[model samples]
Target chain A: MESSQNQFSEWLNKQIHSSNSGAFALSPELRATSLSVLDAGVFPNRKNEEWRYTPLREILSQSPVLADKTQINPALIAAFKEAVPNALHLVFVDGEFSNEFSGSISALDKTGLTIEHISTLHGESRKRAEDTIRQSSLSDDNIFQHISLGLSRSGLFIEIQKNHEVDRIVHILHLSTKSESRNFSNPVHVVRVSENSHMQLLEQYASIDAGKALSVPAVYIEVADGAGLDHFKIGLESNQSDHVSNTVVQVASSGVYKSHQYLLGSRLTRANLEVIFSGAGAQASLRGIYLGNADQHLDIRTFMDHAFPHCSSDQHFRGIMNDQSRGVFNGMVLVRRDAQKTDALQSNKNLLLSREARVDTKPQLEIYADDVKCAHGATVGELDKDALFYLQSRGIEKAEAKLMLTRAFAAEITQEIEIETLRSYVQDRISNLLDGVHASNV
Target chain B: MLSIKNLQVSVEDKPILRGLNLEVNPGEIHAIMGPNGSGKSTLAHVLAGREGYRIDGGSAYYKGINLLELAPEIRAREGMFLAFQYPIEIPGVNNTSFLKKALNEIRKHRGEEELDAIDFLDLIKKQMKLVEMKEDLLKRPVNQGFSGGEKKRNEILQMAVLNPLLAILDETDSGLDIDALRIVAGGVNKLRTKDNAFVVITHYQRLLDYIVPDFVHVLSNGQIIKSGNKDLALELEERGYDWLLDKAETRD
Candidate 1:
């Protein structure tokens, strides 16, 4: 395991130095920092507390070529856009932004919103993107994030002007396709919501049916004072795909950040999300659901930093594991001494449907302030027998009954999604996944 | 049309229903009045095919078939319903959809065409009026956050929608106020027909006041001690069960 981990790290480092991908076109200093970090990167092992439940054997055993000039079916892209029909679509095929499939970027001039591809950004927009990326400090900084930073080929930089409210949702779609060699893509997206402005964004990662790819993406978000951002993500990659993402967000005073994530695909996924309270009185509400079947593995780790006073954060996540699948949730809420009167709540509940299915949930709270209020809870259990019998007693078959209870368990979290269509899409995807899972598995 | 003869049941090797015998014909409503620990709920659960009860010595025949051999859902699809005393709360399962699915399953079992969405909504809307259930309750999760009376009413509403042949009311009136009891009994009365039967198990005779039973049986210590007409319920309500127990003891 150690030798393979080291080989994976060395391979990725060589790729970073050799590849000339201008997608995320980072500044010379930041690029150098990423390479240096990658230089010293010994890939995380099982002994690493954060990577204890997750194994990188599948990812480390592969050698993927940087994807370029891949052919995609237009109908497939059109169908994927239906997930968010009314949004401004930015489509990416194998990490490169597709101008033909995406909505016209020049048409958003009247909306006080600037959406530009990283490779095309010139003066100020380029500097703003670099500055945002430089300002983000990831508490769980690892080799993967630097791999995305040093090797990204394409991504977007979105900035909402101060006091402007964008009604339309901005949809960022990353579509992976099958290639001769295993394809690899890392896209770094940066979003900035200015003061008094509001916007909604949907970042979706999917693949052509059964297409094999490796995706490493990084996202940096900034919510200025008095601003609001509703961010949603749905990962529906293929069963042969592997995805790892690092997202860092900073919220200013009086700002609000609401994030909803539905992870329902991928052979293996590790999603790390960190939020820092850069100013006081900021509030963040996060909700997510991950459903895994077969041999798939899904892991979610969240870090909430209460650096200032009077900031509150609430997080709720649920997982449904079936067959031999596995799920992991590790969330930490830290309240600093200066963060007096901070309120934080964290909860992670999981359901294992098969005898071999498993889950590991850890919810931690570290409060240094005496005047703070914090609560954290974690629960892992099977479906309630009483609920199942109740449904069965009403004449529903046992299979249908189990499906109902499982769907309801997920609905508790998915119902919090503000977008109706996206919610339905996510719910349908979940139902489809569960439908393939036989009732006897429960 | 249900028959239980010498039905002996036990829970975890501790006997609960010892030689309990009862018979019900079509169009008749039999009220079985018993004390708290007299195995009334056990009888209801066993008949409804709930798990965990060992049938030590019994023969429960429903429509000439051994009832205990079928699963709970099979029994339900075969026109049996149990209005639970303490209805289970199923969060996230919508009330309307649950009822619709149950009704459709039963309909399919009966070789009838399944009701479409519009038809189901129409049927449920009319049946909701029988229990005086609020329309909004149909959209909420099943029995979740419902008050005691509301939960009882929801059970009755489910009964009305499913329209079972052999319905068992397991202390349905226990948690209801007088008005709610009346509404629930009224719904039961409206659903009764010459082709169906009911076994109303209760701890009090008050519910019999609204839906007068054709027969009243006093159950003590897992067996029926006395059987008579409706006047027997009034007698038990007035004189209590001590005298009846003493009589049964002396007779034994």
Candidate 2:
């Protein structure tokens, strides 16, 4: 494990030393921060409790060269425009902003909302962006967050002003182009919702070709008093890609935050989410679904901290593993002593569709307050025999019966999606994956 | 329409149905009444081809085809319906959608065209009235959160829609009040035809007062100890099973 860390450090040093002048012309603060974190040797190994189930040896064995700015293909841009026509699109190619591919948001500038590239910010906006980065970086102890913060050149910065309601959904699209060698990308995004405001955001990660690639993205969000935000993150990378993302959210007094994540593709994927309630009457809901097949490995880790009284939170996640794939889910809810009247619930359910498929789930609730109501449950099993028999007895074939039961199990999570188009799109993807699982079994 | 000869069934190597025999032709309704653990439900499950039941001996034939050789779904497709004693609650499966799929599958097997959405809705509406089921129940999950009477009525509603040639009512009146029993029995009477038959299994003679079975059989220790007309049910109601058991023991 130590040798693996040394190998990754050597690779990072080589990439930084051999970079061209254009790459070095970016912010020196980010580069210096990334280097110091690398030199500290804080990369996680099997010994770490949080990373025990997920080994990064396979990801680090082959050095991934840092992907530079690349031209966005016209066809890819056209396809994205068609995929989400109603959304305000902000496109990123190889972790850098692509101006020609992004949609114009000038009409939104006069409505007390600001959406700009973080590197192009001046004065107060730049200071706010730096403060957000510093605050989010101070709380995370993982190497992935440090890498994303230090290496990301330019990313999106969105702020919804106080008392304003944003009707249009802001979509951030991260598209990876084809490369001969393994390519690595780091992208960061910051979102701030002011008092009494409402906003919706969708973040999508995708790749064009089946080349080896790695993506590390960091997100920082803050919901002010009496504000509400609905956020969704979708991961649909190519089969040979590896993705790791970290999201940190803070909710203030009487605020509401809801997040939905759909992880459907990639050879190896990890999504770490942390949320904190800083004031009374705040609430949050986190829901996700992940599907894995063949040699894929999918992991989701969440931490919910209730530091104020009269706060509530709920977390529900489901996973489906087929063939020799594996999945892991770990959720922890912590209620401090001062956080009386705190109500939290967590549930993680998984289905193993094949004999070799495996899943590990842990749902933990640590309460230091005597007046809190907390509950957690975890279940890992195959389809219910009684349910399958009931369907078959109604004249449905065995294969079709199994498919219907699987779809119903997944619907419990997908039904929570509020956006109609996104919900249907996810259902169609899940239906296709189920069809593949049926075919492989046959 | 159905014939069983010396049927012997066991669950978990414990004998539950020992050499039970029965016969029923089309256009006949037969009632089998017995005490608890008398294997009345076991006989129904065996006919429906439920697993975990070992047939030590005997044979059952439906329209001259081996009933024991078919799977549960095959039996269902072949116009055999078993109204479960306790309907299984399936969450997330809409009631209407389940009924539509079931009816379409049976129709396809019988060389009939499938019903479209409009036709399915119309058929279910009419059948719902027959069983006195509410329209909102169709939009909810199949039997999930349903009351006891509602589950039984839902079973009868399914029977009205599928219109199977042989319908076996397994204690459908067990957990129902008199009003519910009347409604359910009325639903069965409406669906009865000369080409179809029924075998109603019950523990009380109360259900017979409404459905009016042509023949009544008293089952004891997995065997039919007595067979008579509707009057026999009244006799048992007056004298109870102990008297019948003593008479049978002396005769043996």
Interface RMSD for candidates 1 onward, in order: 0.8, 1.3
Displacement of the residue A130 alpha carbon in candidate 1, Å: 2.2
Give a tens-digit lDDT track for model 1, residues B180-232: 99999999999999999999999999999998999999888889988999999
**Measured by TM-score, how close is model 2 to the native structure?**
0.94
Global lDDT of each candidate: 0.89, 0.85
Tell me what TM-score chain A of model 2 achieves. Answer: 0.94
Error of 2 at B47 (Å): 2.1
True contacts kept of 1: 0.76
Poorly placed runs, candidate 2 (over 4 Å): A2-7, A16-34, A67-84, A106-108, A137-140, B247-252
| Kept native contacts, fraction for each prediction | 0.76, 0.44
DockQ of each: 0.80, 0.63
